[model samples]
Target: MEDIGYGLLDRAMIHQITERWRHGGIGIIVLQLRHVNAASLEAVQLWESQQTRLFWRYRMENDYFFFLNRMKSDRQMKLILDSAITSLKKGLQAAAAESSVDERAKPPFTIGTASASPSGLGRSAETMIYHALRDATLSMLRLRMKEDETELPFGSGQAGARSEWSSSVGIGILAKAIPTFDLHAQVSSLAKLFESNTHVQGAVIVNQGRPVGLVMKEKMHQMLAGQFGLPLYWNRSVEKIMDDDSLVVDASIPVEQVAQLAMARDISRLYDVVTITRNGKLLGAASIRSILECITNLRTEEARTANPLTGLPGNAAIQREMKQRIESRQPFAVIYADLDYFKWYNDCFGFAQGDALIRYTAAVLQDVTGILGGRGDFIGHIGGDDFIILTGSSAEDADKLCRNMIWRFDGGIKSFYNGEDVAHVVDRSGNRIEQNGVSVSLSLVYCDGSEDITTEHISQAAARLKKQAKQLNGSVHVMGEVFEKHLGEGRV
Candidate 1:
């Protein structure tokens, strides 16, 4: 029998080698055969028999041993397998190239474009044919190769899967990691409250039992500078000078958007800290230094409360805001705005384009909700294609703002939809696709501070109203007296 390479041995061959070693005593014969061979016929015969038996035995033991050992030490096995496969592949490639070169040396000639010489044309064509055949053979071999299901050492898929699973498991880790401030305590001025504590330059602000704004050093100085004639600078309430317009961020908002907002406003000198809140309650103040240190950390935490891709606050943040409104019992409207068919938009354009759409939508939200300028009431990114505008402003003001959002979004319709009458069909792939255009459906749920309404009731009512608005073909749905009647009836 020929000396079969290690690659060719099957399980049956391995078993046979093991059995022969046990019964024929080949191990003892090979160990003792060194002194008996001196070119004599009998000595040569014995030596040859021992060598053959040893070769099979080595294959059997190595195959089983390597397999069993690899189970416990997968990393080592992977290294070994990778090296072996690489070497085998290179050797096979070299062999194929040599075979091609030999075949090309005897090829038929054909007239061609670069036929300046007889040998050149034939050699070039033969080389091209050889390469083509080689590539096809390699591709087919790769397709036929079987992957071992048992081997999945480590890779992006595993890492991604682990990350997603960990994220799902550690959903509320951020809330636990950071300390939440008492809305009432946060409302106090750091300048006065910590007048003796020199290290405390500024303090976070809160309203309605939720974090809403900030009282920074600049604002403090501005207020004190005016009161130079009076000795009441320290005695004055920080609330009096608190910047209502100070950039406030929800814990759930993406840090990237927060960073972008801060950079755009140049908040470092104006207000160096980004105050985090939940439902208008103060969570903590994250400085520019702190934010930049671990952008990914803030991003991950924010993703839980915001959209993973768009960096917008998700339904959780919206729910928190709604709850705060209900608790305050303020007369405010919940304007639920949803982008029309954002999924198709995302699919039609690439994710990068979808990202642009989201950013544009955010800009629209920021522009329209500027009414809440410095006050706590304003707009929030409700993930994907949704946004919520909460304000103590009048219904007409809210309506005007929603209309402005629609108009501004519509103005960019040509760029987004490729001039195909937004509603008309255009080829997305092979099929004709019609986009619903950039339209917003608004639902307003009003609450009187005097009413005994709950956030849950308001949300449910808003959802119903949103459904109604979606029905009117790009119209706003006002929950009106029906929502108020429910509150009056004490059905909350």
Candidate 2:
């Protein structure tokens, strides 16, 4: 009923509890139990141990609705609060009859006796479990929202591709909360931690829950193997040997930025684990190996979906970009570009020259938009000579962008012609044919986001404007009800 702990949204803690849900593990149910239900520590522990088998069994059968369901609610997702409480009620009644112990027993299981014989769950444990699941579910929901909001604008179309881009791979996606030790913990204890967990590369040293230093396995082992290494440091505190200058980054930062900071470390500590924090408290750590691997996966996905001809994003990425912008309800404009007489040019000069023109048109769009467009502008190739531009620029700037695109396109198109004049080109039969070259026609559609605008609406508007622009001469741009403009030989 009270506000859930904000720290539970930390990626490591969320993964830890969700991992418990996935595997029915009971060792680390709640990292900060006090943040959930502080009044009864014993009840929290009892619920964690007693409820895993039963709860996970229920989860397995209903995993479709429990784990695989996507958020259908609005931007804030207000429904998750009620959905979490509802799921808790269902999980509480699961496997009631199969247990050996009777639920109606007069004396409920006490904290001391609950662990030894967890067959009968008490009211305290039930209450604790309810709050824990509710809070955990809420935390997971918020984490998903954060990932979606910060995802790269031009990511791939895969189901979970939002978190896979190097430009938007937040540290939370890769960081895992490995074992953490107090600042005063002896070096020998850290040595044991590494021995016990061979997969762990380092231990985060915390002072009152805040990360202060990092103790890496390779460096510690190297120190201990040195002259008088064991005697000099084995019994001393870990702080004496820990890397205090280790890189610490907030969890919301992109992994690409974090990778830069990680490599900037001294060569001796280049491979040290990077600690991730939330609100200045230790959340988890990401190894250089994990960061690099995440970056590689992101880049691979980008390259897979990019337009081969011009290296711009393709249809799927374009659709996704438009969809996100529309859903965001932000005022933005769409510029749909189509080349005029492209097929005739291809027929006259062959496909090779036509392809070169397509690439050149893409370059012109990029340069014009980069100079005149607002921040976060997007450009995509919709296959062939069709391109799309989405920008948050003002109407005046949008007009300028269209005019500049036409100017640059007309100027560079002469190079593709056979002679100094762009009106004539050599045909396949070695005969000269009259051709005016290719000119761009831009269909500009502006949406204030006040109305319910869909991608279909924008596409339809662009198609309608394209028909109108083709009726005129030279390169031109047309917008609904605002203005009709043309450049070069013909003016409208």
Best by TM-score: 2
Q: Encode model 2's per-residue lDDT on 193-264: one tens digit a residue.
A: 899988777899999999899888877887897779999999999999998888999987878788778765
Clashes of each: 7, 0
RMSD of 2: 20.1
Please report the candidate that would top lDDT against the real structure. 2
Clashing pairs in 2: none
TM-score quality measure for candidate 1: 0.37
State the lDDT of candidate 1 residue by residue for 307-408, as single tens digits.
Answer: 544444466655665666666655677667776556666766777877787777776666666643224554566666777777776656655666666677
Which residues of candidate 2, in runs, are more than 4 Å off? 1-165, 168-171, 207-212, 222-241, 250-252, 277-283, 320-335, 367-378, 390-403, 420-436, 443-472, 477-492
RMSD of 1: 27.9
Q: What is the TM-score of each candidate against the true structure?
A: 0.37, 0.51
Question: Would you list the clashing residue pairs of candidate 1?
Answer: 210-280, 210-281, 211-280, 211-281, 211-282, 245-374, 329-449
